[model samples]
Target: MSMAAPAFNLRTDLDAMWLLPSLKPRIANQLAGLVNTAPAWMKNERPLVSFSFDDVAKSAAHSGARLLAEHGATGTFYVSGSLVGTHSDYWINADRDDIVELIRSGHEIGCHTHGHLSIANATPERIFAETRTNTRFLRTLEPDLKIDNFAYPFGRASPGLKKRLATRFHSSRSTRAEVNHGRIDLQLLSAFPLMDRKMTPRVIDRILDRAVQTNGWAIFYTNDVALQPSPYGCSPALLAYALTAAEARGIECAPIRDALLKIGAERTF
Candidate 1:
């Protein structure tokens, strides 16, 4: 039997405008960062970078993944099961075949909840159910898949949800726009956006440079990578530019799982 469609529409409901310069969300996110932290010490000799795609758009699964592969790198694709194979106003979601191809091609399949709901607005029960449904659906496609990473939908999180997720995932990423270094909160790992509308070569250089200087982990996240990308997505050229910049700096690019292993991230709860 096919899974039922989620009531929320990703095209409309996923907008994070409320998170911009808002005192409430800003305070909430800051407060969440202070508590329920699963701290990890990052120990590595060289800088590390990871490219991750949230929601697994068709272009991301194809063009974005291809670009990474061309660079001899792999990325983490955070999949929301309900959106798989569905069409949004901006782009189409990756189907079962695309996901299978990603797995076969050695990409990491991360979690983004089943309905793409923001954890800040979800009840505890709803959060559990969403994760369970998403994991179950993902395993149906690849029974042996090990989904150990998660990205909060819309980059929203709370202390309770963060605590709950820490038990289930090896690491959870956020849209905090910073590089991970030293002592990091694994429950809310900081990540920068690679949006076409907002990113520039200078900005990419600055972020990568900081990672190299600090010997840190730089996790860059984007959605669809196409010629004309959505506001939240980046163009193929921009994606390639970031990858090439990272490579030129002698940074090692890998999926989140592999990067974590290489960096020797150890949890200190």
Candidate 2:
């Protein structure tokens, strides 16, 4: 990494191009290519950076997951039980075979929810039920693995609900973008949400330099990859920028959960 890289200005909001019919596949491939070129050591490290996608969508199956496999990078897919087979959700095209393929590809399978809901309104018991049900269903798919990772639907959770989730799940996520504090709160893990093509290469370079300066972890969450008609996917050019930025900095990119795991569990206060 060189000092020549400029300061990056971070922003929220996915690109609107994902909603378009064309340019989807191309962008998807770029996402795959980004992952396919990753370094090996970063794939297994303490405080490593990795990619994860929430809400099973076609872009996840066709674009995002593909790109992750290309780079030999593994991501955790948190899917809602109800949406697994439904064809109606924005990008949750539960390709049964693809879901199996993702598992076979060495990716982690986590739960999003039985149905998408914000824990803001639900009681702690309700939150626990939601997470438990999804995890139970996911177990049928892969009996040997433990369901450790969870993402709060809509990034909503209360303190009480957080406690319940922490007791049951290893980690949870929200839209907050920063490095993990190396803790296991299971409620407020920082995440960078992906929307259309707003995240560009130049933008990614800026973030990596900042993270290096701070020595903090950054985890990016996306709904899908380069699938067409995307209202929340980044383009290939942009996806590669972020991935390459990590590579350029000599920082290995890895799955978010694995990164923290290598650091050991965070103590509960």
Candidate 3:
């Protein structure tokens, strides 16, 4: 199946984007972790876990929020202001009303850039520019909204860019698959997908078990939720199942914003 093309043209270098193009940012991410860290003093607490939905697909706005709320938890929605109410290569984006509903229902709104631009594909100037546009656009939707978190588009960020983001948001999430534990870097908090392409129930169960054993933080991200989801998304049933399993394990489920507070990191904005 052909993917739906994004409305805006991507300006990434096609040559540098070959064979694990994300590796460039991944390396920079590792280096950034060494310096300019927002250390989380996550001690004497139950294992923490957060569910985040990127792009805020229509299905995610509906089924994703419903499932989390049913479990008495809320997921973070990392939105691209420019993509709202549009059809993407994956799924139809969430509309303005859905954004309002999510805020009203207690879900978080994190920045994902104005046009969902991949950090690997954008220059430092464009990165800052896009970030500003994303925040400004989201505020236009609701004047008093507080966006204190961000997710790197395509799970990529340069060292310089990561340093800049660290001062701006409470936390910046990445797509690296690792459990966050003991003196972790808040700027590039690690997370992995819950989609079929990357994970299975048994795999997620083990991830939850590890978090429980270590008193660590397990952050999982996804895109859409429906009977048929995109490659970057999971089915509604899988989402519900993951939540149920986490709850069954007695994991403390909270949105990224709330979970950060519990670990002794305060939102700067």
Candidate 4:
């Protein structure tokens, strides 16, 4: 049977010019620092790493999943349910079947707001509604799916939104460029990007080495995964390098939910 077309527009508007202004993100970053929702008490014996994809693109659904699987690791894909099967100028977004397959293959599916709206700019009601809508859509694919992890759209979240996200998920990740270590905020867990322009092999190696040295958790985020990737995306080769680096350092690679479990942040799966 053919699936019904999405009730909303399918295009993504992630461009800096289209979303929040430059100064707003800076302000959001500052606000995030002030909020304390869920504090992660770190007791990690070894370094942990999670390779996650936000606003997952189809290439990530395939190549990203494959790369992780090749290394006997899995990833967490933070999906905007409304964008399933959609196409934007920069990405071919993952569809419903891809999400199902991801779960079947042992990848975690985390939540991004349905409209991909920035948590920093949205009202509480809007934030709740969008997240509810996203989970509702995902439930159609896997009725038993438990979305215990979240990512702020555009890596922006207000203080109030941070509190709300903390209450709703086991952990919520932000696009902050650092590793989560001793006494970190679970609500705004730090994640560095794996984009070509932002990270190289040496940078990845350094980060992995640091995580191992500190016995911390490093979460890497990205969008699409292809040989020729989008401007904000990481190439497959870079993704593989990250996985290899983590493995070489004896760092355990897991999805966000599993990593949280390892750190004693228990959630009902």
Candidate 3 per-residue lDDT, tens place, 1-269, comes to 99998765344543355335667656665676566456666763788889999988999999999989889999899999988999999799999999999999989999998988865677656876888899899988889999999998888766777767776788999888988887777888889698977789999999999999888899999998878888999998788888889889999999999989888875434
Model 2 residue runs over 4 Å out of place are 1-47, 181-186, 227-229, 266-269
Candidate 4 TM-score, true structure as reference: 0.89
* Candidate 3 clashes between residue pairs 3 or more apart in a chain or in different chains: 4-89
Better of 1 and 3 by lDDT: 1
Query: Per-residue lDDT of 62-136 in model 2, one digit per residue for the tens?
Result: 667666666667777888877777775455566666777778778877778777665434556876788778877
TM-score per candidate, in order? 0.89, 0.75, 0.88, 0.89
The whole-model lDDT of each prediction reads 0.89, 0.62, 0.85, 0.86
Comparing 2 and 3 on lDDT, the stronger one: 3
Which candidate leads the pack in lDDT?
Answer: 1
Q: What is the lDDT of candidate 1?
A: 0.89
| Segments in model 4 whose C-alpha atoms lie over 4 Å from true places | 1-25, 266-269
For model 4 the local lDDT of residue 249 reads 89
The Cα error of candidate 2 at residue 2, in Å, is 79
